[model samples]
Target: MTDTDVAPDTAAWRTPHGTSQSVSQNHLAGEVWMLLRRNIREALRSPVIAFIFPVLFPLFAETLVASSYARVSSLESFPIQPYTAYMAPGMMLLAGMMGSGYSATALVLDVQTGFLQRLRLLNVRPSAILLSRIIFDALRVLPAAVVVLLVGLALGARLESGPASVVGLLVMCSAWSVAYGGLFYIVALTTWNPQAPLAMSPLFILLMFTSTAAMPTSLQPGWLASLAHYNPFTYVTEGARALMTGPVTAHALLPAAAVLVVGIALTQGFVIPLFRRAVER
Candidate 1:
């Protein structure tokens, strides 16, 4: 046959058929499970390092502040259930930040190593990469949180809220973790520099200090208090705190929801275009 008369290999060149498409769809699911397992394995390999912050921070705070605050009636006015009630939210935020930051750094490494490009060329779903990273982050934080919670309970930290509140708190904390992870996605997508995560470090520190983590807003300077009042993290901490303590406040819950919504929108806005550019590059 003449060259023009010869048909192309339709089987090879054509788009994936039913089984192939099913496999492609399942690719991400399989990868997610594998990625999660890998993350757990890595974390297990470094137990002390992984557990240090989540476990110790709450204990230290409870030991130091819980008694002093308990003695002072003025400070005691704030819902002071188990010191864990206050400490848990802060730990949650810290875990979220660390997880997201580390995930972003990992993304940078993947980009540098050309893994991102290889993944892009494959039939993997784009969302799966980000989702898996987030899942890994959440799972990484869980062990630490569990350790801290157990310690807190041993230390007489009580949860005044019902089962629903406990579930809600965990769910909200997870959402916060995912939202922060998305923010990291933006950072990783926009910057190629290995040190880019450093830019976020100050912000993380600022968030911890500005919120109700270390001290009540009433104790903070007026200007600092105002900033914290407006800070979205303040809401998250407050909401989580309310969930643990008895007196749930509208002030905390409303702002937390608002912040979550705004964060999701802002992160997506930046991440989508940044991801596209990174993929194209």
Candidate 2:
């Protein structure tokens, strides 16, 4: 056989190889599943420390505030039932935030240990890596949400909306989880200093106090009320609260969507660059 005869066979083999590589690139399904499974196993093996801060702190806050607030007739409008209901979703968000924070910390560790570099070299889709981390964080929040819901029920909380609405509420909360996780991804990428997130922890606590979680908007001081009007967290808490209580308002959905959008945009801005930097190394 001459070179011309060999050339066609070589081309044929190259074609199949290229096609296989393309297919492999597109299909990261196995990689994502494996990553998710590994995350779950690690979570299960770990101590309940993650659960303690996200789950217990919120429950403790609800218990303390509900008991104290129940006593004052002046605060009767914000009763235990509605108050606990209002606070439940905030707790859910907090759970997600904490989950994301811890996951980011882990990512930082992976970066320092050079595991992230190894991940970048793999055939796995670039998106799959970030998505897998978010999925892991979201899964961590699920049990905490369940625990909060049970506590709410025990505290006389009830959902006025039907099952569909409840599901919507869960979906919205999950979106917040992913959005917040994305923000953490940014933090992880920009700086390796653990203190960066620790410094901003107070902002989370302040968000709860500024929102409708603790009291009605009407009851808030004038300046705080104005601030709450623009706060995205208030929208989420109110959206969840409206679903939990009677008199659902369409307005709540708008801000919930807004927060989700804004959160996504802000997260992407940081995450994309961070991802590129990681891949470059």
Candidate 3:
């Protein structure tokens, strides 16, 4: 009911001799960890947004594409043996993309419900608030990434590389998701509207379709090929493909890494300031 009534262990207190004091400092790392756990638990309670769609949508897309386009692998010019193998990396990336926006939407909901204000009242740092959500956003897609990879193997994909590359590929997918989802955070924080994130959902489809996700650029029409050349996700997909299939060379990985780094830097450069202002408002 009052500070005096609070347990000493959980609250700041001075020794009887006044020789020392225990400060209940809201450390950034500790606060972020606590809030990240809360976010994960809350998401698990509503698994549809946090889990189901992320896994299912990518699985469906991969299966549907592989089934319809199985003949592509038979072509002499095709890169991989089974078309499913080629489709696997892109599908994993798509899972990362699909699993995003939940954090931004959740953050907006928290604001609307006054939960963020409550956290502020408790002296939680703004950086902790935003960083926890960002980390949660990256972590939430991991299950879907794993599921899609397993399904790809089941559907006739092969892992030419060893287990280490698989881990690297998954990590790349999570980082890509964080970068791609930055737009949603910017929109949500800028507008303070839950619906704003939904409007950006079509960008996922556009990115996949316009890029070399499902098909190589050589077979694409002139316009589509031109688009694929500039689409950053194409590099991500190709780099992921190299990791899973073969030739884990710098040629593929470097461009993807650079694109990811720039995407993350640019979007977060905007998002951090925007989120801080939003929460402080």
Candidate number of the best TM-score:
3
Residues 1-281 of candidate 3 have per-residue lDDT tens digits of 22332233123223577543422274688878877877887787779978898888789877996899999889887888799998899999998888577888888887776676656666678888889988987898899999999999999987888888989898899899889999999998888888889778778888998888889988789999999999999999999999999889999999999998999999999999988887778
Candidate 2 lDDT, tens digit per residue, 151-243? 877886777776666666666667777777776667777888654654555566777778776766777899989888877778877777666
| Highest lDDT model number | 3
What is the Cα-based lDDT of residue 9 in candidate 1? 12
Model 2 pairs in collision: none
The lDDT values for all models are 0.63, 0.66, 0.84
TM-score of every model versus the real structure: 0.76, 0.82, 0.90
Candidate 2's TM-score reads 0.82
Put down candidate 1 lDDT per residue, 1-281, tens digits, no spaces. 12221112111212455222222546667756644554455455556544454455545655666556544424555546544556666665565555355666666766676665655555555666666766776666665565655565666665677667766666676667767767667776777765675467556668877877766777678998988877778888888777766567787688887887788778767876776677668
- Give the root-mean-square deviation of each candidate in angstroms: 8.4, 9.1, 4.9
- Give residue 154's error in model 1 in angstroms: 2.5
Q: Which clashing pairs does model 3 show?
A: none
Minimal lDDT window, size 10, model 3: 1-10
